[model samples]
Target chain A: MRHTIPPRSGAAFTLERGQRLTVIDPEGEQVADLLAFSRSDIDEVISSGRSLDYASRIFLTTGDALYSNRSNVMLRIVEDTVGRHDFLLTPCSADTFRILYDDAEPHRGCFGNLAHALAPYGIGPDRIPVAFNVFMNVAVDGDTGALAVRPPLSRAGDRIVFEAETDLIIGLTACSAPQSNNFAFKPIEYEISS
Target chain B: MRHTIPPRSGAAFTLERGQRLTVIDPEGEQVADLLAFSRSDIDEVISSGRSLDYASRIFLTTGDALYSNRSNVMLRIVEDTVGRHDFLLTPCSADTFRILYDDAEPHRGCFGNLAHALAPYGIGPDRIPVAFNVFMNVAVDGDTGALAVRPPLSRAGDRIVFEAETDLIIGLTACSAPQSNNFAFKPIEYEISS
Candidate 1:
């Protein structure tokens, strides 16, 4: 699938109810990670465990509820653009990048996955960690239990929107699928409302 | 803030040249912990302390290169949404939840976070383990060395993207920031692509 990135970022948004968030993946060719938190609270929702689970992309949906340690409602997807989401899935570092691309140089361009998200509070990798990956197409091999990564199901100007009851803090990786072998470039766009 | 959610059970894809990934946060949002590995080489990635610093998110993102026990590249963020992607953070769990949350509920819901995302892999908390909440906004009180919850700076639709040069596997969580009533409910939106 061929994808054309916009001139601006992948998405643009505004915080208000009944608003919309959009992504133009012209060919289901872009994947993103979505996370949320309370507006008043000054922290993230998932510790490390749940964040990794979210990457699997199993329980993300309209009715699916993501609860924090405090048991507060994180977010509800009011609308969806392109295809469904995959809460489980993440990128790799230089080592794995070399493993895949053989000739690539080794470097830790950015090592913080999900666990790194909560380090600010001294909550090291033992607590808050990995996160969900949306819009990337991958399937588990029934027999081998292997996850297959290929193209995506989104297209140009495709968008997704959610209604955040509380303030949400999101972390997105717009273009590092091949950690060391980036080459993936696109500007995602979005709209958000309270 | 606001966010956009990918479709249900859906994903996006992007193609690249060589290995050049791009990652940018919405604005000033800080992304903390991060984990990466190979989709087909899960064991190798897990056992190796390089790509995924099990004990902490600190060394994970440092300029140091990560290698699996067998010496494979798990991940290397070509770009970073937040500057502190290499910091060491911890994963949130049920035990921690019980110790943190203000109210007393069965299971405490800390494990629930991981349970929800790990259900698909059939890897329960016992099998897979806890996770790290990557990119969560937080801070520490200088005077008391106490963990503080800062309003997550991640705006709506803020994203961090990386190239999947390797089949990466990771875990995540939303931990308890001291600033809140013990159990901080910082919601988040997450996604990824290949």
Candidate 2:
């Protein structure tokens, strides 16, 4: 299945074992929140801490497996065009808007979009976990150890591909937070296939 | 309503606004994972990051408010018997067992317990967020910046009380991981009242 998730929106789909999902930044400099759960046991969702421990690295690249909280392999990064994805920061939520921008406007965020996307499967707001902020730029200050959210470094058509290790439900949201840049949020393009 | 949660198990209940939930470590050395979701919107669950940001502190104490990812107040700490509670580390999951102990045994962890407890309400694994690791002793090493997991500093009868700011679905899990100590996991007693 293939889809173009509009800005500030999300999409959900089932990706069988051995299948692959490719997330593309069609216009470049756009951010997407990538999340997944085991089809049989949703509790065994992706855990960034486990992945970092298994890989012994802070950032992920091709050949690294995305491990679940159960230490089970969920997805393997088969390819990558951008290598600066963020796994430490949680997804941007409404609270993020209120804190960062001091605006109470009901701006669409990855948290709410993921909830709406997974609602059909009986997943609610409480179930949304921290997502892999794909194509997003976050640099840790070496001296102060502070994380700085920067603009995307990916160019047009830059994408990352992952092969599922088990039957999985995938959720992707085109982040609409203006913190990414001072401009409007852009759409995201993706494809899933066996 | 009041209940005793057995070691390696968990319990779930609904707490309405204006009500208070008090968790007590009767035997004192045991640790518990505390989680909550808004009764009206599950997505608006307790967020440790936001809570820390709101209080501008690392360890939670009395008078600190637990904030949601949306930055809304979920619960306020009305009283605390033990002032050293962890709000940073996510609950111990199966992966924690595999990494820390190399044991593939299906030992109970907070992640599975929370999922199992909330399953009756249609909340599955995907919704289980990082929890407030109440009574667990994790000290960060200043030189190495490594977190050392130690035995609980709480003595018998230690407890913490929180007043619900909104109607909430609360989950509590008794941690059974050997990381606590060589002693067997102990039971936890709690009560909810308006």
Candidate 3:
């Protein structure tokens, strides 16, 4: 009935300016896989990240902001769960795939995914040299104890919002991170704003 | 090292040919999140349905030659495995950092992790796109039991290799899809060849 995303609970929420939605994982742990782009141009990639590097953190909870490569702002974390964030483990092309299939060479893993996605826009993986990791969290273990890979503050059901800088293309997917709270992969949720 | 990806006792395997990597959800009951691309370029978005439809079911596989907006073929999926592979997902933006912490966003998630590990090459999110999920069975059941999803028959540790269609970039991430099978979010493995 509206230009919106339906919650897993079976309710639809239209994303508007200052209007937000909270997609719940229901599970104890959920990793919100978020991707934002310009409202005017859905091709621009958003710029996001975590700083304090804490654990159990959430996004859009008054901490992170979605940015663009042109240095434009997209969304901002107005709410959060867990506590910290990390924009470090984004995917790309590397030698992993090459070695697995018995090919002739190696490549980068991170840029591979992005390169295929930008085909309509006339871009290439070579043009992709940077990216961001939104709500995903990380915990780096040190000798004494595990380091707070991100800050620690976000809890479940937290929310975030971003003002699109242009028409943007978003691709969202949860993670099965081997390096998170546990090797056990969890589900997550999020919302967007004009 | 052996060109073969050792089989994990309970993992799945795929034979990737035709320049595209087909991820079979061995659980037969679970959906897989397919992530891949040609490393030669990063702006292409392989994870979207519209893009896949435009590219045909031959969605970027281990060897499906990916052509850029400039009509350039990027890297190919050299190898494949069900237990392990690099799939691109999740990341933060500049706005994400400003929202989560007092300073900047942290770099932790897959996209973040990738950018950090490959930052030396100057690869970033703006250059990438959300990856496509291949052979990943997602069952959105309707009122009809008429839709019977096929069981994904893959052997654990079985792998496929690809000859590069062009210089490529490959990103991978074992998915945690719960749609097909009870969604235990069991981990899958992948191995690349080149």
Q: What is the interface RMSD of each candidate, in Å?
A: 15.5, 5.5, 16.8
Q: Give the lowest summed-lDDT range of ten residues in model 2 chain A.
A: A139-148
Instruction: Say which docking band candidate 3 falls in.
Output: incorrect
lDDT tens digits by residue: candidate 2, A109-186: 788888888888776666665577888776643223344567888888999999999999998988877866325688
Between 2 and 3, whose TM-score is larger?
2
Sort by DockQ, top down from the best: 2, 1, 3
Query: How well does candidate 3 reproduce the true complex, by DockQ?
Result: 0.03
Better of 2 and 3 by DockQ: 2
- lDDT of candidate 2 over B1-194, digit per residue (tens): 66899998888889999999999998888898899988887767887655654454556778988887667889999999877776645666776777767877857588888888988877767666668878877654322334556788888899999999999999998886777633678898899887
Sequence-dependent TM-score of model 1? 0.42
Question: Tens digits of per-residue lDDT for model 3 on A1-194?
Answer: 11222211111122344544344443434343444444455445543212212212222245445555434555555555443444423332333233233436643322444444454555433444223333445443212112233322345554444443344454443433333323344454555433
Per-residue lDDT over B1-194 for candidate 3, one digit per residue giving the tens place of the 0 to 100 score? 22211111122122233344333343433333332344444444333212222233222444443333333334344555532221222233233344434435342323443344344444554454444333342221111101122333334434444443444445443333222224344344444443
- The model with the greater DockQ, 1 or 3, is 1
RMSD of each: 19.6, 5.3, 17.4
* Segments in model 3 whose C-alpha atoms lie over 4 Å from true places: A1-23, A48-64, A92-135, A139-167, A191-194, B1-194
* Regions of candidate 1 where Cα sits further than 4 Å from its true position: A1-21, A24-27, A37-43, A47-59, A69-71, A106-128, A179-184, B1-194
lDDT of 3 at B178: 27
